[model samples]
Target: MTTRIDTRFAELAHKGRAALVTFLMAGDPDPATSLDIVKAMPAAGADVIELGMPFTDPMADGPAIQAAGLRALGAGMTLKKTLDLVRAFRAGDDTTPIVLMGYFNPIYVYGVDRFLVDAKAAGVDGLIVVDLPPEEDAELCLPALAAGVDFVRLATPTTDDKRLPAVLKNTAGFVYYVSITGITGTATPDFGRVAAAVARIKRHTRLPVAVGFGVRTAEHAAAVAQGADGVVVGSALIDVLKATLGADGQASAGTVPAVARLVGELAAGVRSARRAAE
Candidate 1:
């Protein structure tokens, strides 16, 4: 049952480098432009794509991501539209793993069973439902894995040894290690601590640990890559997209290229990290 996520991580390991995982809000500004941005990600060097399912109240998301979700929702982004985006992206590129990242409310309302079917049909490889916990596996996690979609779980800095096993219990795809304790994009992750945290989580599960939350630049990605199997960049990319938006708060001509360029730099950082470490 090797999923696309598993395969991608294994491939990165063979190359002796970390993966660059990019997060983008689905239908931000509008569906068409958002799709174009996603379509350009792999070519820009994103090893994995996390398509955020825009929910009204994204409790776990920081301000940047919260605003991005609101913009996507305002532009008519819905659970179905997000899946359609994934479907459209899959039509052209089949190898880049697409993970639906967001809170669980949208999926719950969409109907768990139905969402699973549609997501799988759309070629979604994984999911990151931030609100769902290990105790609630029956709600979505178990069913998602049953339907062949990897259910990725988040392990925070607060997840001590006593709680690590429970967090990793049903987690698939990879363990997302939140580098900071608070909301995302507020502070820089202490790379030394990140390396140690990744090592701690690795002892509990064989799943690849991807460090996220505080990763904002190529240097941050590179430093975290010294220990993490993958670097997940979300808020930073949203900030890039936001900065390039037009005066009318619409997608300008510069939006896609700007994001792609940043991703390319981050990818270079991740790929060269191992060399730097040696």
Candidate 2:
């Protein structure tokens, strides 16, 4: 099945540029404002949108993303509301792929069968369940693929060649390669190593490889885009959102534009990457 994710990557390949994949927590600050940010992403040049399903214990997430989840949960966000956010976004925009990102507990509690049905109905194109490894495909990965939703897999620097095959085995949409070792938003990635890592992964799978983690600026996106099929920005965006918040930690007037402005810059970087490489 040619999902929105596959089609988007194909379109980018035709354009000869890498994709700008943006990740944001659902219901961050509040549900309504969070939806507005997501709705604004595509226009700001985001080719793929990863909407975070706020779980209490996001082991892999950095402080910024963790806090974003807490803010959403504190504001009474739930798995159902996260799905509703996707449904609402779909009402206006159908082309941009929405990938539900985060851990597995929330989905497990929500019931995988029902969540998959609702997610597809909500126009969600894919999922990035970080905790479910290839070894546990039957638990969710296989089921997600069977339901026609692209199951994007994450590969880190530690994912050796021996493990690469399993990681890419059932991976759909695109392969998200974590450029850094730690959590999101910490440390700058070594671009040379990143490029080599991307090339290494490509040797194993035909899937588009997207580099993420520590990509906070336009320059970083450009450098990574040189060898990657997509560049993902999350913590930096969350930092923008956090900086724009008012004293009460609510979305201020600058929140949306601040995030969009950075995205625009990052998009420009991504768009100009091929030229830079040449």
Cα-based TM-score, every candidate: 0.97, 0.98
For all candidates in order, the CA lDDT equals 0.92, 0.93
- Which residues of candidate 2, in runs, are more than 4 Å off? 275-278
lDDT of 1 by residue, 1-278 (tens): 88889999888888888899999999997899999999999999999999899988888888999999899999988999999999999999988999999988889889999999999999999999988988898999999999999999999988999999999998999999999888877788888998999999999999999999989899999999888899999999999999999887899999999999999999989987873321
lDDT of 2: 0.93
CA-RMSD of model 1: 1.6
Model 2 / residue 192 / CA error / Å? 0.4
Spell out the clash pairs found in candidate 1. Answer: none
Give one digit per residue, the lDDT tens place, for model 2 in 3-94.
Answer: 99999988888888999999999999899999999999999999999999998999998899999999999989999999999999999998
CA shift at 231, candidate 2, in angstroms?
A: 0.2
Q: In lDDT terms, which candidate is top?
A: 2
